[model samples]
Target: MELINQTRASLIDYVCAQIATFFPDGADTKAAITRNFAEAMGRVEKCFGAIRPWPAGKFNYLQSAQYCLFLYYLANTIWRNDDDSGTATRLFLLNKTLNGIDLFYEIQMPDIFVLGHSSGIVLAKATYGNYLVLHQHCTVGRNYEVAPVLGEGVVMYPGSSVIGRCRVGDHSVISIGTQVVNRDTPGNCTIYQGDGGELAVRPAGRNLIEEIFRV
Candidate 1:
């Protein structure tokens, strides 16, 4: 997927402009903002490569929501390290308002944590894997102080959750409404809700990432 395009360039410029509003009239501040914007743009582009033609239009609801979520992550990263406290605070508030997800947790942006929508998702401070695709209403949170360590190519369907100190292996699927707590799952498996609301784990029927994404 082409990451650098006219639309993406415009989107970057738009976000930079919004960020600049919080900075004061000084050359040093301007330079810092420029550097931060470049870094954020690079990370966001790298992570969102599978979803090409980003910064979608208003009508493209799903893509647009994803775009907003990406912006939130980028802003959160910048807010963490930037010296301008006021700018950081403004961006943090903006991110929370747009995505409605808790920003108190840490997110490793190198791995593409693909969010299907901006609503009904809560992510805690967990070790997320590469190509993590999370549908709406999914939650990956902590149990007490420990969080799940997810492997590559993990997909959590709508209403599914993997909470507590669990280890979800690569290519594992958490089926819709399946809740996995404090369990270790093997690679290439699926966790689904069985009879009587009991959760069952089995080998995955397909490689969902291979079918959907180029990676």
Candidate 2:
């Protein structure tokens, strides 16, 4: 529902801007604008079916609507994540580059945090697990050559990476500037290898979302 609301607001913004030219008025054009908005949403629904990572014989529009919106917003949310700060709830925020498909109007991201974008980030795979977090310049490729199976509460910090046939266990952290290729991590572990050496992995800060979105 959180992601749904976020994406809904995004849809309003997108559609409003689109029709601003033709229906720029107080109440005179409100009805017409509303109609246009509905049509736009339907188009987005179609694109959602195409871009989603999984393939199905049919789609549940309502469920897909909820999911598609998250992907749409994540692709455009810059870099953001809802941090838990040692809490049991694991939430994710993200940007546009973390999708396995070329997003047109629909791009569904994993409901996890993606710290940085606009630095050549790309997700070309489909077998990712839940609670996966990512940073700038990371790439999850296609096929089992390097498919990542992230565990619960996995974090990928700045310049960190997990590429190709990697399965990280629960509560594992990939530290800054580290590149993991064809490897597996155990639960409750910190995988860091940077210029600063390996920093201790902690439950992410509380204001991580606001930090990423700068909202």
Candidate 3:
């Protein structure tokens, strides 16, 4: 994998600089960044490599979506393995400020996932599966202290939401602007709103997950 416009050392500096802009105590996180950056980047490489055609084997700092995932990996890695809550918090805040996304470090996102347009996306600490695709303004939130469990190859389109104790099966597509609130959908289907504004499911005509990822 190639890191564009940023060498490993430069990327570390860039992240530290970005954190400093929002948090004056950024200097304390340099060690954690140096310690966890390589592992986090390896995760990024694996994710990017799984994507089709574009954004594969390349980590471009200028690309907001790629950078957003990178920050998430870094923050999550630090939080999971190190005793540096402050560092992880700074990274999470920096990512939110830069990407307009609210993915907390504690959220256990899948390893093979992609983000489209990234902004205004809020993911709660839910059960996510591999090859997950999330578009802008898409949300996976909790309702009444219960979150949804999404299976493999689930795609949440722009403005779509899944809240509460829902089981979104494998290869299911949550259609744009559709909200699945405390509902369930079987695998290999598309969940859309019917003419009467009710949730409807139908067999998916195509494998959208395959189109986006090299499954």
Candidate 4:
């Protein structure tokens, strides 16, 4: 499913990714994280779109054809990382085309993403829905503790880890430098690590107006 304010989210996500690359604790710099993500993603999309092979101004961003082209670009990154076969690659496109994305652990797939300098990587019985993002050195493995079911638009930050059987809801943002194990999280919530493997959730309907950083 497409996220609410997907463009904004995508943009912010990209920026956050960049900062994370440079700074281990970038997410703590909330304002920089927010600003960079939006700008970087927007530029990549715009620049890439301009360079794509379009005939005589026929490339309309709203059109299905154009959208697929962009998705293909993004999907290619994952494909290359997993060393996926052509057939597997096509299947990914098909899934992305039909369902936006469905990289669940149980789903038939060959190419899984692994970022560089990212080790200790693992995932089992996890359903990685579409637009899934992973930064360097994150892990998704199961413990006798919990198995994870990742929803669409799920992101894992560097040094952040998850293990056990739990569900991470759609459009959920996993905070950088956070580690989660056997935690059930709500949709569209910003995730943070607290003491004892617990998470701090900022739910949508909940007010952030007071800067009520719950401990």
Predicted structure with the largest TM-score when compared to the true one: 3
Candidate 1 versus truth, CA RMSD in Å, comes to: 4.9
Top candidate when judged by lDDT against the true structure: 3
User: How many residue-pair clashes does candidate 4 contain?
Assistant: 14
Model 2 clashing residue pairs (backbone)? 71-107, 71-108, 75-96, 92-112, 92-113, 146-164, 146-165, 147-165
| TM-score-superior candidate, 2 or 4 | 2
- lDDT string for model 3 (98-153, tens) is 99999999899999999988889999999999999999999999997999999999
Order of models, best TM-score first: 3, 1, 2, 4
Q: List the residue pairs that clash in candidate 3.
A: none
- The TM-score values for the models, in the order shown, are 0.75, 0.44, 0.96, 0.42
TM-score of 3: 0.96
Q: Per-residue CA lDDT of candidate 1, range 1-215, in tens?
A: 23433354555555556556544342233343455765666566566555433442221213556555556555556665665555455555555555665544145543466667656777787887888887778898899999899998898899989999799999999988898889878889988887875678887896788765557
Error of 4 at 26 (Å): 46
RMSD values for the candidates in order, in angstroms, are 4.9, 14.1, 1.3, 16.0
CA lDDT, candidate 4, residue 3: 25
Which 10-residue span in candidate 3 carries the lowest summed lDDT?
21-30
